[model samples]
Target: MEEMPLKTAEELEAECLRLLHANMTTREIQRVGIVRTHADGSGPNWTYNQLYPEPTPIGKHDAHGIIASVAGKWALVA
Candidate 1:
């Protein structure tokens, strides 16, 4: 199998924001968070969490900075 191309930081952040917006609006999720994982045996990976209403996995990202950016923006609105 061919290896997938890695996403840039900007792309990761945009995707995280998009997923957060979609979930918050559609699923009515009140709160969300990010968790770091090593399931891929890579250096680091991040997963979005739906903390309120229910704990659910929304999406995964590669950059922690991107995740932090999403969380900071969320704090501003939340």
Candidate 2:
């Protein structure tokens, strides 16, 4: 099988922003947060925060899918 192309940082950011805008409310966006494992498959690596206008947290499964999709690795999943 052919390998999939990785998304650029800008493209990933844009897609994330689009998802937030489409699925989250203004309040939810402000409170949005993402957490992921480190590259070494250890525990959580870091956390990020920003001022926006939302209040809901993204679910783990959804977060995994989003990350995979943006990274262009979705097709590798069964």
lDDT, candidates in the order shown? 0.42, 0.39
CA shift at 22, candidate 2, in angstroms? Answer: 0.7
Off by over 4 Å in 1: 25-78
Model 2 residue 27 lDDT? 17
Over 1-78, each residue of candidate 2 has an lDDT whose tens digit, in order, gives 554443333444555556655543421342334333334222223233342442435543354344444444312111
Tens-digit per-residue lDDT, 1-74, candidate 1: 33233443445445565655564332433444545443442233555543344533442232233456544332
Model 2 residue 24 lDDT score: 32
Q: Model 1 misses residue 35 by how many Å? A: 10
Q: Which ten residues in a row have the lowest lDDT in candidate 1?
A: 69-78
Q: Per model, how many backbone clashes are there?
A: 0, 11
Write down the lDDT that model 1 would get: 0.42
